[model samples]
Target: MEQEKMNLKLDMDVQKLETKKLRKGKHKAEEDLKSLKTDYKKLRLSMRTVGLGKTLEQWCQEIQEEKIKVGRWERKFQAAQMQNRSLENSLSESQNERDELKARVAELEKTVHQYRNRNSVVELKASFGRIEQMKRTVEELEMALQNCEAKIEYLEANDDHQSEQLHYFQDQVTKRDHIMGEAVV
Candidate 1:
């Protein structure tokens, strides 16, 4: 009877651990889904700016250009994120490492907060010079994203306009041909 009770207790402990892991997995999956949705929204919006009337080749070229531009910024963003993670992990490992990491984290956190909480461009300019650099980089990325979108829209709009013009000219040519045929007959 004593052994049976111990076995049941162990089984319950195993079940609890499994449940905890399952819950963690579910949470991570949800986070990934949300991140993917944001990325998809940005991607679809960027692609839609490209127009239908453009030749397949031109559309392809535009897509490649967009990809290159986005890829560069993404690499920079990813590198920053990775560095932050490494700092975090090092902080978690030992007392000495933790103190050094904590100080680094504190400095960065202060800088980020200062930049984020600034109410005016003037205040930001006076407070954090690196903040200006970060803002400039962000603005450049936003402009690149916008320009790529505009290029796609221009291609599509021009294609539609040209298509309508082509159809009109085609009708006129057909009408002239028919008239010539009738007159000749």
Candidate 2:
């Protein structure tokens, strides 16, 4: 009985050790499986990122589409360049026309200024002529006024002489009348 008990205890200890080893091996296998799953996810993400997930035909098709888009954009860019050149040319023409117009306006203004100066000269000359004519008229009027004054002075002197002659004649007539009356008496 004692030998049998020893054998049984040893067998139990051996079973415990084998259970512990199996548990450890199962935990390590689970960790390896988790690591493998994470590596598989990273590999798939890398494949997509590197464009390796698509087939060669799909890549070729996408490249062809991109080339078509590039061609279209190039055409549009060329057309825009042509339009820009046309606009630049038009702007240059407009600027030239504006410069010509400005020159014409300046010329017109200069002509107007010249005409105004001529008109001013003519007006000044006319004014001088009018002033000269007025001066002559004033001189003639002064001469006529002097002559009229002289005539008035002569007429006044003649009137005074006539009044004195009349007074002397009347006095002589009265003396004759008085002598006639004395003779008659």
Candidate 3:
């Protein structure tokens, strides 16, 4: 009977030890699972951050490229403006020269009339030659004036076309800026 009691006690102690070991192993597994879950959450957050960073960098590069394009357009517009002003100045100078030539021709015509009434033969011949020369000069001046007028017209048309182009570019830039604003929002 005593031997039977000792064997029963030994079996009870083994069962207790096995139960404690199983509880410890279960606790360790739970801790390991919690740690793995925390690590996964951190990795997901880092991935999101990296994605956002790449998106921001791409946006910045696009903005910089847009700025460069705008700068080039502005420079072209300014150059066109300067060219228009120069053409205007040239047109003014040509008009002034035409007016002066017309005045001189009128004065020559009056002198020719006075010479025609004189009776000296040699003086009459000289006056006739001078009149012919003056007429040729007047014709040449008229032709030059006409050419200047045509050039002025061409320049004015060109300036109008350039102005239209500049407005179109400005509108495009404005639209791009609006789009970017919406995207950022």
Q: Which candidate ranks first by lDDT, i.e. highest?
A: 3
On the 0 to 100 scale, the lDDT of residue 175 in model 1 is 82
lDDT of 3 by residue, 137-164 (tens): 7677677767767776776787688778
- The candidate that wins on TM-score is 3
List model 1 lDDT by residue over 30-112, tens digit each.
99999999999887666554323356897588668756855665565465556545544443444444355455556755766
Model 2 lDDT, full chain set: 0.64
Screening candidate 3 with a backbone cut-off below 3 angstroms (N, C-alpha, C), the clashing residue pairs are: none
Q: Between the candidate structures 1 and 2, which one is better when assessed by TM-score?
A: 2
- Give lDDT for model 1: 0.63
Clash tally for model 2? 0
**TM-score result, candidate 1:** 0.30
Off by over 4 Å in 2: 1-45, 48-51, 119-185
Clashing residue pairs in candidate 2 are none
Clashes (candidate 1): 4
TM-score of each: 0.30, 0.36, 0.55
Ranked candidates (lDDT, high to low): 3, 2, 1
* Model 2 CA lDDT for position 53: 63
All candidates: CA RMSD (Å): 32.8, 55.5, 15.0
Of candidates 3 and 2, the better by TM-score: 3
